[model samples]
Each structure stands twice: as structure tokens, then as C-alpha cells.
Target: MKKLLTMFITFFKIGAFTFGGGYAMIPLIEAEVVDKQNWIDKEEFLDIIVISQSFPGALAVNSSVFIGYKIGGLIGAVLALMGVVLPSFFIILIVAHFFLQFRNNHIVDLLFKGISAAVPVLVLSGIDKLAKSLDKSVDNLIILIISIVAVTIFNIHPILIISFAAIYGILFLRKKVD
Candidate 1:
């Protein structure tokens, strides 16, 4: 019961304070779940990030549910999800009510512009962290290059790229021992 409450409060704080999207929440999640609570190690956290991204939902919510389940089962998952979602839900409701009034305000425009500028930095920080953790093996490098090219030049969907990479890994990257 205590642990469930803690999870709810922690995720509520994260959801309430985080300005940008999932990428922006990574550092905060890491600090709380990995560093402060010691629920999972860094490698496990990285795995959670990867798994969260691979799925369809928002990364922050997915990760919170994952961690909550790991800590306290199905009820915990529900609690954590509720915790993270409630803040955004209420904020959006309040903002929606007043946003039209402020839509033409220059100060509000400037504030949004500043927030937009900062979002990329937060996203980049997440990319840097993920990059540092990636194994620099030749096959992995090839896959990375292919994924970049496919996304940037060919404008391919990321899901297709990830699927190809998974198939490639299974078919050609398998290890054999005598």
C-alpha cells in the first residue's frame, strides 16, 4: 500500500512538472526510478526505454506502467498510470478552457516559442544518452546507418525500419559455436 502510494506520488510529480513529452521525461524518470529508489539498474532502465519506444503508446506512460508493474503488480500499474495521466488531464482541461482567450497574447506566444526551443534540447539529451549506451559493433553500426538513411533520405516509416532491423538481426547476426 505504501509503495503503491509512493509510485503514484512520484509519477504524479513527474507528469506534473515535465514540460515536454516523453524524451524530456527520461532524465527525471531515471533519477527517481533508477537513482533514488533503486528499483532498477541503468541497463534495465535502458531496456525499459527501448521497450517503451518500440510499443505504440506514449513513452512516459508506458515506462511508468512498466516500472509500476515491476514494483507492485497490476494494481500498481493502474495507480502509476492514473498518477501520470491525471496531471496532464487536468492541466489540459484548464488550459483548453482559457487557451482561446490567450491565443493572441504576445507574451503567451513568446512563452510557447521558448518552450518549443527547449524541447529539441531535451530530445537531444535523450538521444545522446541512448547513443552512449548503444553497442558499437559493426552489425549494429550498419543497422544504425541504414536506419538513419531510411528515415532521412527515403522517408521510410520507423516501424518498417525497426522490423527490417529485427529480421536482419535474427537471420544474419546469429552466433554459432563449434
Candidate 2:
């Protein structure tokens, strides 16, 4: 019971404060879940991030659910999901009510523009952390380069990229125990 409440509160704080979607929430999640709470180690957190990204749905929600289940089963998953979603839900409701009124406001426009600029930085920071955590091997580096090129230059869908990567990993990266 206490653990569930703590998870809820932690995720609630994360959801309430974070903007710019899941990528932006990565560092915060890492700090709270890994550093502060010691719920999971950095390597496990990284694995969660990868798994969350590979699946459909928002990364933050997926991660919350995964962590919740790991910590406290089904009920925990629900609590964590609610905690992370409630803030966004209420904020959106309030914003939707006034969005029309502020649609033409210059200050609102400027604020949004600033947020747009900052969102990329947040995502890049997450990427930097992920990169640092990755195995510093030639194969991993090659895959990373290929993935970037496929997504950016060739415009391949991420789902397809993930699929290919999974297959490649299974076929080539697997090692047999003797």
C-alpha cells in the first residue's frame, strides 16, 4: 500500500511537470525512478525505455505501466497510469476551455514558440543519455547509424525500423551458450 502510493505520487509529479511528451520525460523518469527512488537500476530503466519505444502507445505511459507492474502488479499499474494521466487530462481540459480565447494572443503565441524550441533540446538530452548507456561496440554503432539514416534520410517508418532491428538482433547478435 505504501509502495503503491509512493509510485503514484512520483509518477504524478513527473506527469504534472513534464511537457513536450515522453522523450522529454525521460530524464525526469530516470532521476526519480533510478536515482531518487531506487526502483530500478539505470540498465533496467534503459531496457524499459527501449521496450516502451518499441511498443505502440505513448512512451511515458508504457513505461509507467511497466514499472508499476514490476513494483506492484495490476493495481499498481492502474495507479501509476492514473497518476501520470490525470495531470495531463486536467490541464488539457482547462486549456481547451480557454484555447480559443488565447488563440490570437501574442504572448501565448510566443510562449508556444519557446516551448517548441525547447522540446527538441529535451529530446536530444534524452538521446544523449541513451547513447551514453549503450554498449560501445562497432555493431551497435552501425545499427545506430543505419537507424538514423533510415529514419531521417530515407523516411522509413519507425515501426518498420524497429521490426528490422529486432530481426537483425535475433539472427546476428544472438550468441549460443556452449
Candidate 3:
């Protein structure tokens, strides 16, 4: 009961306040869950993030639900998900209700301008989290470099990039000379 309330409110706060979306929320989640509340350790948090990324669905919400469940079982997952998403859901509803009329407002414009500036920071944080989570190895490094170069320079379809990577690994990395 008490834990459920805590879960809802904490996620509610996260959903309500943070400026950026999933990536931005990562740092905030770390602060609240890892540093402040001690709900999860860094490794668990990272593992949850990884699992969330691998599966289909929203990353932050999925990770929060998993963490919440770990902490307080089924009820915890429900509460954490609510905490994480309720604010965004409501805000989107309210914003959608009036967004067209509000779009031209000077205050709203400035607010969006401010929010746009935060996106790069959010991306950096997301990258940092991924770096921390992934195993450090030459193969990983090479794959990262090739992916970046292919995406940035060639502007290839993502599917092609994934396919090539998969094929490269299967043909070369997986085979051993016996």
C-alpha cells in the first residue's frame, strides 16, 4: 500500500517534470531510484535498461515497470508504470486539447525553444548509459565505428546496416578454425 503510493508518486514526479523524453529521464531515474531511494543498484538499472531496449515498447516505461516489479512485485510494476507514464499521458491530453491555439503563443514558443536545446544533452546521456552497459571489447568498438560511419556518411537504411553487421558476425566472428 505505502510502497504503491510511493511508486506512483515518484514516477508521477518523473513523468511530470523532466524536460526531455526517455533519454533525459535516464539521469533523473538514476538520481531518484539509484541515489535517492536506493530502489536498485547501478548494474540492475543498466540490465533493466538493456532488456527494455532489446524488447519492443517504450524504454523508460518498460524499465520502470521491471524495476518497480522487482521492488514490490506485481503491484509495484503497476504503480511504477503509472508513476512513469501518467503525467505524460495527462500532459499530452491537455496539450492536445489546446495545442493548436497555444502553438502561436510567445511563451509556448520560448518554452519549446528551451526544450529543443536539451535534446542533445539527452542524447549524450543515452549514449553514456549505453556505453556503460555494453561490454568493452574490440569487436564492439569496431562495430560501433562501422555503424556510425555507415549511418553518418552513407546514409544507408538501418535495416541494411543491421543485416550487414549480422552477416559479418555470422560469417567471420562466429567461425573458428579447427
**Candidate order (TM-score):** 2, 1, 3
- Cα RMSD of all models vs. native, in order, equals 1.9, 1.3, 3.8
Enumerate clash totals for all models, in the order shown: 0, 0, 1
Better of 1 and 3 by TM-score: 1
TM-score per prediction, in order, is 0.92, 0.95, 0.79
Residue-wise lDDT of candidate 3 within 1-178, one digit each (tens)? 8867887788889889876777778877887888888988888888787667655678789888898899899989988998888898999999999999988899999989988998779868867876887778788789889989999999986567777876787787785423
Full-model lDDT for every candidate: 0.89, 0.93, 0.83
Model 1, 1-178: lDDT tens digits are 9989998999999999888999998888888988998988888889889888878999999999998999999998999899889999999999999999999999999999999899888888878877887877888898999999999999999989978887787788776211
The worst-scoring run of ten residues by lDDT in candidate 1 lies at 169-178
Best by lDDT: 2
> Model 1 segments beyond 4 Å from truth?
174-178
Per-residue lDDT, model 3, residue 71, is: 88
The worst-scoring run of ten residues by lDDT in candidate 2 lies at 169-178
